[model samples]
Target: MDIIQLLEVLKPAKDVVTVQIASQKDPLTPWFDLAKAVLPAAATAFVAWRAMNRSHRQFEITSTRQAAEFDKNLAQQTKALRVQTQIATEIEIKKEECRNVRDTCAQYLSLALESNRYKNDFDLASEYILKGNTQFIEKRNVAHENYLESSRKTLSARMLLMTYLNPETSPSFFESIKNVDTSLVSSAPNFGGVVGKCLAECRMYIEKKQAEISTIATE
Candidate 1:
């Protein structure tokens, strides 16, 4: 039963005892009996109150612990988000750097290919000059050998004259011609014009290759 109902029942019983004592001749016996009965009831009510108080304290402690755990979890999640953001920023920076490096390498490779083409043309011209020189040295027909030697000499002279006249020209062309002897062009017919045409073709080839390389570099 509720505390109020139990108290009501106890009150009527106490009132009946009081009435009985008033009617009796012994007053000490009634007082002693009332004290003994009321003391035990008060003790039981105090125990019940203590048990409720302990349960309320335990609930408060449990709620505080749960709130602390939630805060700890939230803090950990925030730290992880910060770490992930930093990592993503670093990765983006590295990707940009890699793109720049790749572009630079592509430009360099394009230039290198043009340079290789020029070198190949230079090597071919040098080979032709060497072959002409060897044919001139072999004296099969004196006039034909003289003509071949004259052609070789004209090639050498044109290369030298271009170098002397256009000193600021590309060293790649000048270097290719510098090793040849220029004394064999004694009286060869139209050899100078032929050599000039060959040099012009070489210049045109280099210019074309350079233009192509420039386009690639820009891209």
Candidate 2:
């Protein structure tokens, strides 16, 4: 038979049958199935890890900030303490100077009295008076700057001049500085009523400074 006639003869008897495919897909391949099963869990684990890492970083930052603040506070306290200590040391030094000045001034007063005893030798009296005055001025400077400069305890030049001539002769010195006459009160250098009174004031000043220093230390 001819090829066209043979093809025509191979056709179905009644009609050609048609096949229809369903909408849904079949099961996936092995690798795709494994990904489908594990991807969600892996994604969840990744997200949780990221959250934990973020929290850890935040904690580290907070701890670092707290540590820095603590250091700053400690440094401030240390500086304040050092300043208080320096102030206390300075006050103590001033107290010592005050004591020295008091002793030296008492000695100068006694020396002046001794100089006045030489009534016959004018040159000797003048020499001793000049020496005592110079020594007293030198010793009184520091205490005067601190205590007497603002008060009536300061010695005037005129008063010092009279005191240089005679230790207990100056009315201003006797009235303002020391009340009683040293010779009449006592012959000893530091035992006179005036010396005692001045020393009391010095002690009072020292005590006041000590109280202030203590207050600073405590605060």
Candidate 3:
């Protein structure tokens, strides 16, 4: 071939090579720019997702702690209420016991007064018997002696009543005496009816008071 013909063929080949290189470089330039632009956005999205997940976990933990605290407070309040109820029940029981003691004392006092009256009657009966048998001066002496004995018995009964009913004094000894005297008076023949009635009434009062105490104690 001639030089000009060879030159024309080489020129077309060189131009084709240049056009391919430029096309590849054009696509690569845009791809590098896109990667550079998206890198920061992708990193930011990752960081935001991690932060949101951490916040969610923190909130869950806080909620759990709050729930636990609430349960503890509820338990404490329930315990307090139970303690208060127990204390109140004890107070009521003590109050009932005091009332029972008072009523029992009153009953004993009533019995003592009744016994004094009966003793007075017995003294008068004795005087009548003695005076009916005696001459004039003897009858007067017997009546006077009987009156003195009756007065003495009445005073004794008064003193005994005071000992039982006084709040300043302890009623323990009187309580023991109450059962013994009630039994003794009940067994007596002539005075049994009057004494038995008084004993029965006193017993009834005691039983009622005991029932009240039991009811309070149960609470």
Model 1 scores a C-alpha lDDT of 0.51
RMSD of each: 20.2, 13.6, 11.7
lDDT of 1 by residue, 1-219 (tens): 976567678787455433233465576888989999998999999999999999999999999999999999999999988876766665555455444433432332333333333334444455655778555333434435444544544554444345332335445434333322221122224334433543554455355445654554444
Q: What is each predicted model's overall lDDT from 0 to 1?
A: 0.51, 0.53, 0.59
Query: Candidate 3 residues 185-207, lDDT tens each?
Result: 45344444544554554455456
Per-residue C-alpha lDDT of model 2 across residues 22-131, encoded as one tens digit per residue = 68765676779899989999999999999999999999999999999999999999998989788778768756655554555555445434333322233334455577
What lDDT would candidate 2 get against the real structure?
A: 0.53
Off by over 4 Å in 2: 1-27, 36-41, 44-48, 118-219
Locate the minimum summed-lDDT window of 10 residues in model 2: 149-158
Instruction: Please state the error at residue 97 of candidate 2 in Å.
Output: 3.1
- Tell me how far the alpha carbon of residue 93 in candidate 2 is from the true structure, in angstroms, after superposition: 3.6
In candidate 1, stretches whose alpha carbon ends up further than 4 angstroms from where it belongs are 1-23, 28-41, 100-219
TM for every model, in the order presented, reads 0.32, 0.42, 0.45
